[model samples]
Target: MRSGRLGLSLGLDLLGARICSFDCLYCEVGATDALTLAQKPYVPAKRLLGELSAFAASGPPAFDVVTLGGLGEPCLNTGMDRIITGCRETFPGLPVAVLTNSSLLSQAAVRRRLALADIVLPSMDTLVPGEFAALNRPHPDLSLSAIRQGLLDFRSEYSGRLFLETLIVGGINDTAENLDVLTDFCRELRPDRVDVVTMTRPGAYAMAQPAPPDTLARFRAALGAAATDGGVGHGPAALRSRVVDHKGPSSGPAASPHETMARVAASLGRRPQTVKQLSVALGLPEDDISRAVEALAREKKIQARAELDHVFYQG
Candidate 1:
C-alpha cells in the first residue's frame, strides 16, 4: 500500500541487470528443484553478457536490471559472479536486482557474490518450521532460524534496497499467531519494504489459496506504520519478466499465433471455443496443441465442457 517517495523508475521491467535467487514453491515454471543447479548450458555466461552489452550500448529499456529469475535459483547458477560483473561492465550506472527465496543467503560466499546487485527482493513465507515445510517445502538442509538470520546478516551488509516478500496464503498461514511471529521477524529484518502478494495463477498444490482481500487489507494497515515510520511495504512487482527460454510462441507458416488453453469446471469469463476449432484457427500441430490444452486445464487457467465424447474449452 505505502512505499518510497524517492524518485525511481515507475515504468519498466526490461531495463537493466535483473536476476532472481530462488526457484519458489509457487513458481510458474514448476518445481524449483526440477531445473536443479546450472541445469545445462542454459543461461550461459557469455550469452547473457552479450545481451547486457547490447542493452547498455543502446541504453534505457535496452536493459535496466539483471533480474536472476526464470525457472530456477539464480544464486545456484555458478556463473552468477560472472553475470553480475559483465552486467556492471556493460552498464555501470544500471542497478542490478535479485528476486530470491532468502534460504540460500545464509551462505557467506553466496551473500558476498550477491553484493553487486543494487536491490534485492528476498522472501520468507513462514516463521515456524512445520508451517514452512508445509508451504515452501524447501530443501532438507534449510531451517527457519537460519533463513531468518541469513536475511538479517545480508541486510546488515548489502548497500542496496532490500524488499522482503511474504505472500499470505488464505487459511494456511494467516492465523493470528503466525502473523504475530512473522511481524516480529520483519521487525528484526527492518527491510526497506514488506510486500504482500496472492495467487493469480493456479499452483501445483491444489490447497495453495490466496489470502482474502480483507486479510490483505488488515496486513497493509498493520504494516503501513512500519513502512511510514519504520520501513515500506507493498504488493510485489509483477512476477519478473517473460523468460527468454521458449523460442517465441509456437506459430505456423500461415495461421494465427497459437494460444494456450486449459480445463476448468466453469468458465471464468471467456467465451467458449472447441479444440478442433482452436487447432485450425491457431495452426498448432495437433499433438502439441493437445498437450498445451491439458497443461492449461491442470493449471486451472480455463474451463472445460463435454457433450457425448467431445470436450470443449473456455477461458
Candidate 2:
C-alpha cells in the first residue's frame, strides 16, 4: 500500500504477533499482547529471508521501499540486523525502512541493528514522564530519559535518514508545556524530518481523541523558521514539522476478490477505515469493499465500531 511518508511501500511483518514495548493508547493495531523489552528471534532471520525471497520471485508490483514493521515495534526483533541485510540482498536498489516505537533504541545493540536501514522512523509522543506513561503506557523498565538519550546517541552515530514522529493525542500530550519540551528535543536531535500527527482512526483506547487542528497548527508554527519544507509524501528536509496524513490511493493494478480481501485486511490492520475510505484508498468500487468488509467481519478477521457517525473497521 502507498504510505503518506514512504510512498509505495511493502511491509515485512517481523513480529507475527501484537508484541511491543509500549501498549500505546493510540495504537491502531489494537492493544499490545506481549508488552516486554526482551529481545529474541520472534521470527527467525532465515525463515523471514526465505519468505522474502519467495515473495520477490512471485513478481510483485513495484514498491518504492521495503518496510520492516508490522503490528508491533520492529526493533524488538533480535533478527532485525539479518533481516535488514537480507532485504537489501533480496531487493537490490530498494531502500529499507524500519518503523520503531523508540522504546528499544536505548540499547546500543538495537541502535547498531537499526543503523543498517536506509530510513528509520521512530516516534516520541511526549517528553514529560507523566504524559509519556499516560499516552504510551511503556514497559515498567523503560525510562523516558534513557529513551531520549538513546535517540541523541543514535543521531550522533547514524548517517541514515531519521524521521522523528510525534503523535499528539488530545488532552494527553497536546499541552503547551509538552509541545515546548518536544520542540526543544527536536532541535537537539536534529532529525531529517519531524512529523507531528494525531489520531485519524479508532485507537486502542476509546478516550484517545485526535488533537484539535488548531493545536497541531500551533505546534507547527512553534517550530518557526527551523521547520523545513518536507512533510508527508515529500523528500527529506531538515527538522520539518508537519501533520502526517496517511490517506492516499493505492498504486498497483486492479486486484481480484481474493486479492482485494487480503489488501483490505492488511490496510485495516494498519489503521481503521470506513467503507468509503477503503473504496478510495484501494481504488476499488464501494460494492467490492463492502463485500470484502462483510466477509472479513464474518470470518472474525476484522471488527467494526461506530464512531463519529460512521462505522469503521479494524483488524
Q: Can you give the TM-score per candidate against the true fold? A: 0.66, 0.86
Q: Report lDDT (CA) for all predictions.
A: 0.57, 0.78
Off by over 4 Å in 2: 1-5, 224-253, 262-271, 276-287, 295-302
Highest-lDDT candidate:
2
lDDT of 2 by residue, 1-315 (tens): 112445556667888899899999988778999998888899889998998798778664456677788778889899999999999999898898888888887899999999999998888889999999999999999999999999999988898988877788999999988988887887788777766777766788898988888887777665432334334323221111111112123444566889889989987876788888777556677888999999999999999989756899988
Q: What are the per-residue Cα lDDT tens digits for candidate 1 across 114-153?
A: 7777777787777876677777776666667888889889
Q: Give the Cα-based TM-score of candidate 2 against the true structure.
A: 0.86
lDDT of 2 at 101: 85
- For model 1, the stretches where C-alpha displacement exceeds 4 angstroms are 1-25, 33-42, 54-64, 227-235, 239-315
* Model 1 clashing-pair count: 23
lDDT of 2 at 276: 82
Worst ten in a row by lDDT for model 1: 7-16
